[model samples]
Target: MKKLLAECLGTFTLVFAGTGAIVINAATHGSITHVGIALVFGLVVLAMIHTFGDVSGAHLNPAVTLAFAAARRLPWREAPGYVVAQVAGAFAASLLLHFLFPQDTTLGATLPLGSDAQSFVLELVLSAILMLTILSVSTGAKEKGITAAITIGGVIALEALFAGPISGASMNPARSLAPAFISGHLSHLWLYLTAPILGALLAVPLCLCVRDSTCCCASPTSGKS
Candidate 1:
């Protein structure tokens, strides 16, 4: 229960602050700029990880939760609850944004600036890199502490900086889903939903190859011989 609440609150804050930057930038005629928006996403994620890291691992991203489960760091049973909390939180944030900015369209929903195929490949690679970084920095299923927060936050910021103009640097299904659903920008939504998951899953094999087998793969026995 506490974990779910933490996930919800953390995700809500993520969407509210991150997408709010986009909405405000558009409303104010680019006062925030692309760089500023990227920084906001990164900083907010850093803050959330610090705030809720101890409680719920501060997933705030369904791709991340699923990746952790695939990596055997997190139990599969908890993935659904985390995903639900994240999506609910994201929707809550988007709904609030809609209320505040009634005339605003898209509400910072991620859209492909290029062809769907281009954005799809970009999202996949970006998510894989992000997931690999998370796996390296995280402890078991939990992404808490200063190291995890800074490294993970840095990776997100970096990716968004480079990829925001292309694929909106979504990297998270819940983050993309809420605004798209609310703002009626559903076209090309399938790529955002599928690519990131596939990318994160792809990272599992890569991690297993580079990391210790015990760290990346689940073991059935307690003893090591």
Candidate 2:
């Protein structure tokens, strides 16, 4: 229960601060700016990891939780609980955002700036990179501590900065889902849900390349969990 609460609150805070930046920037007529919004996402992730990483690995993103499970660092049985917590937290944040800024159309929902295929590809690449970084920095079964936080946060920041104009750089399904769901802007929701999971899963094989094969493909009894 403590772990679940930690995961929920961490995810809630992540969506609140990160998506809040987007809503605020729009409300204030770009006062936060694109770079500032990206910074908010990164900083919030850093803060959350520092806050809850020890308890639940700070997996605020469902794709991330799934990726860890795929890499055998987490148990499959635990994945659903984490994903549910993350989605719940994200919806909580989205509902609050809707109440706070009702007039905003998208409510920070990510939409493709160009073709849907382009956004799909970008999201896949972005999530793959993000998951790869998470796996690389994580120590043992934990994705916590200073190094993990900074490196993962940095990767998110960089991805958002470079790709926000194109695909909104949403590497997390929950991040994209909450706002799209509440705002009725779910036209491209499928891309987000499928791309990120595929991208995160793709990182598993990549991890095997640089690290010991056991590090990424461990079984339940291989000491990963």
Candidate 3:
């Protein structure tokens, strides 16, 4: 139950803040550029990691959690609970955004069906890099020995700046899911889901290799191994 709650709250923090950035991005009327949105989004992840990473690894994204599950970093039984919590948290955030900003049409969600294929592929690649960085910094090799909050936040910030324009840089399935629920668009939902998962999947082995390198004193198992 504690783990489930942790997942729920962590996901809530992610969607609430991430989607909030989208709201800011659109409503700011050019005040908040892509860089600004990415920064805010990254900060949100950084903050939540400190608050919830210890309890549930702060896996606010279904894709990230799923990757961990596939790698056996997390139990399979917990996957559904985590995904459910993530989706529900995202949905609740969306509802609140709807209430607070009822007049706004966009929910700060992601869709790539109509977007250029090249752009979509670029987004996927960027997302992979971000996920791999998160795995490395948070887990092993380049653990950096920094606080989880700072490291994850920095990762998110970089990802946002580079990938926000392409595919909305939605490396998170839950982040994309919430907006789709409210905005009534599922056209490219699969792209967001599949691409991010693939990115995460690729990161698993690469992170393993990097973490195994003898640059650090700690063993690979110490981090995400």
Which of the numbered candidates is closest to the native, going by highest lDDT?
A: 1
For residue 49, give model 3's deviation from the true position in Å. Answer: 0.2
TM-score (C-alpha) between model 1 and the true structure: 0.96
Off by over 4 Å in 3: 113-116, 139-146, 213-225
lDDT per model vs. reference:
0.91, 0.89, 0.72
* Clash pairs for candidate 2: none
lDDT of 2 by residue, 40-62 (tens): 99999998989988877888999
**Which parts of model 2 are misplaced by more than 4 Å?**
219-225
Sort by lDDT, top down from the best: 1, 2, 3
Cα-based RMSD of the predictions, in order? 3.2, 1.7, 3.9
Q: Is candidate 1 or candidate 2 better by lDDT?
A: 1
lDDT by residue (1-225, candidate 1, tens digit) is 888999999999999999999999999999999999999999999999999887888989999999988888887878899999999999999999999998899999999999999999999999999999898888777764688898988999999999999999999999999999999999989999999999999999999889888777763221110
Deviation from native of the Cα of residue 10 in model 2, angstroms: 0.9
Worst 10 residues of 1 by lDDT: 216-225
State in Å the error of residue 142, model 3. 15
Q: What TM-score against the true fold does each predicted structure earn?
A: 0.96, 0.96, 0.85
Report the C-alpha lDDT of model 3 over 1-225, residue by residue, as the tens digit: 665687788778778777787786677786777787888888888877777776667788887777666555566666788889888888888889888888777688775534657555765686678777666655421223447568778877887776666678788888887788788877777777777778877777776677764322332242322
